[model samples]
Target: MTKSDFPALRMTIDGGRLVPAGPFDAERLNSYRRGTVVYVRFTEEKDRVLVRKWFAIIDIVLKQCQTPWKNRDQAHEAIKLALGIVNLSKTVGGDYMQYPKSITALEDPELQEALEQMTELLSRMTGVDVATLKKETAHIVEYEDHGPTTGEIIEHESGAASPDADEPPSSSSAGAAESPSSAAPTNTDTTETPVADLVSVETSGDGDAPTPSPGARDPETQRLIDFAKDVLPLAANTETTGSLLSAIEKEWAPEIKKMSADGQEKAKAISRSMRAIFNRQASLNGALDFFSDALGCSVEELGG
Candidate 1:
């Protein structure tokens, strides 16, 4: 069947089941067998509107800037690059090159983040504060249509969403997870493990012990600790160091959600520091050591 031949449905994840959220063609849904696979993308209507409106606003403002863009698609690609929202591919010569990553593929949390970064970029380029920028763009953005009311709960097929968001929609694409099946629900609480309880300092036994969870700490400190927990486990011996750095890079998206405007700038700085060691061997250990020096802790204390 052609792409347009498929029907779409709106649904949400409730108690690990896909519950219809709006009027759906029941006949189409019944055509598939129980084990038939489909694609799922989890994005919200509001997020889609925000992204398009921001892009339109940027396109308008760019006419007066040093680098003017007449083409909206090209402008969008440039914006993605300037904001570091890209994927890296190695060239035939073994050097890294950047290509624009799809903004639509971003999950709810990630989409909001890209909009924020786009706002900041537009602000700097236009020499305006966020409040004023919004005011100026409000009219232009309003000219665009807000996508489907009672629309399908869908995702970009790239990343996972937090537990609080809606479930993904089904598509006919193979190799993708079927909607609502094989999708595991995530926990909503962290209180089960006492913050003071000690987790292993390293995945390998050679490292130190009794690293306490930063429970009840201020949100900022706890945020970094949580990030370290997620990223540090990939570090083992020399063989596994690449996994560690890749983990750290992957954490960049969700990790910055809690950061303030100032904190975000500082994060970019720290990211640059991390990227400096990407070419070096033992980069994971170097990164952990760097974090320890910056945070005033030993390497052993770096993990969860």
Candidate 2:
């Protein structure tokens, strides 16, 4: 019989035998054939709770911000894109495509990493303090035990659960949770110099590209340079590149406003480095030239 003929069953695997956990139709149990293979799905309540908390955090952030995204799914995709939590592939037409992995499927370590990244982005976007947000959202996941004990039994031949199936449908969109892949599949090609790898670049000793002198080294500038290198590659491939830049710019504005003239000049230099790195991925020289022109200083100033 087809899977549809079998009744839904919730059971435990005890010593290689299926032990029904609760009331199940006895009539349907007889339908099982000897040696017939049945599929099983194990559910992790902790993971489910974490997913709930993630959506809750997104809901709070979306409610407080004026973002291009209209709903949590869109916001989730945007955050993943900006943070580089996605896979890349090319279409037949040679356009790039991003497949943002569903957070529900992430392993524990990856899920923690995603939580950290999402929290950082949400804080930057909404001006909400990360500590406060974390404290407020921590208790938001109220677990319900109404469902089949921790694991559920199934009769499916093969395949996996839909990414969209993990969460309930949102009011912003009907039916079911929107999958990340549901977004536009095509993207403009952004292949250029790989920005992250350039952090290790050594000066060739030729006048072609000058290395920063040790005397010019400033801890703060070095920190910004390292930050810029980490995120620039992720930003370049996203259609919301402007959005990422705008968020960082927003974060920098107030700090810039409070600086003294000299401090403001230094802040401007730092800002130039950020903008240059984000705007031009064409060549190393192009990015450096933009930084130098904007800073109106020697290339070595990038280190300070």
Give the whole-model CA lDDT for all candidates, comma-separated.
0.47, 0.47
How far residue 165's Cα lies from its native spot in candidate 1, in Å, is 25
| Shift of residue 262 alpha carbon in model 1, Å | 5.8
**Model 2: CA > 4 A from native:** 1-47, 93-96, 141-304
What's the TM for model 1? 0.38
lDDT by residue (3-39, candidate 2, tens digit) is 5644455454579877755555334555678788767
For model 2, state the Cα shift of residue 106 in Å: 1.3
* Backbone clashes under 3 angstroms, per model: 5, 0
RMSD of 2: 17.6
Full-model lDDT, candidate 1: 0.47
Candidate no. 2 TM-score: 0.41
Residue pairs of candidate 2 with colliding backbone atoms: none
RMSD in Å for all candidates: 19.3, 17.6
> Residue 169 of candidate 1: its Cα lDDT?
21
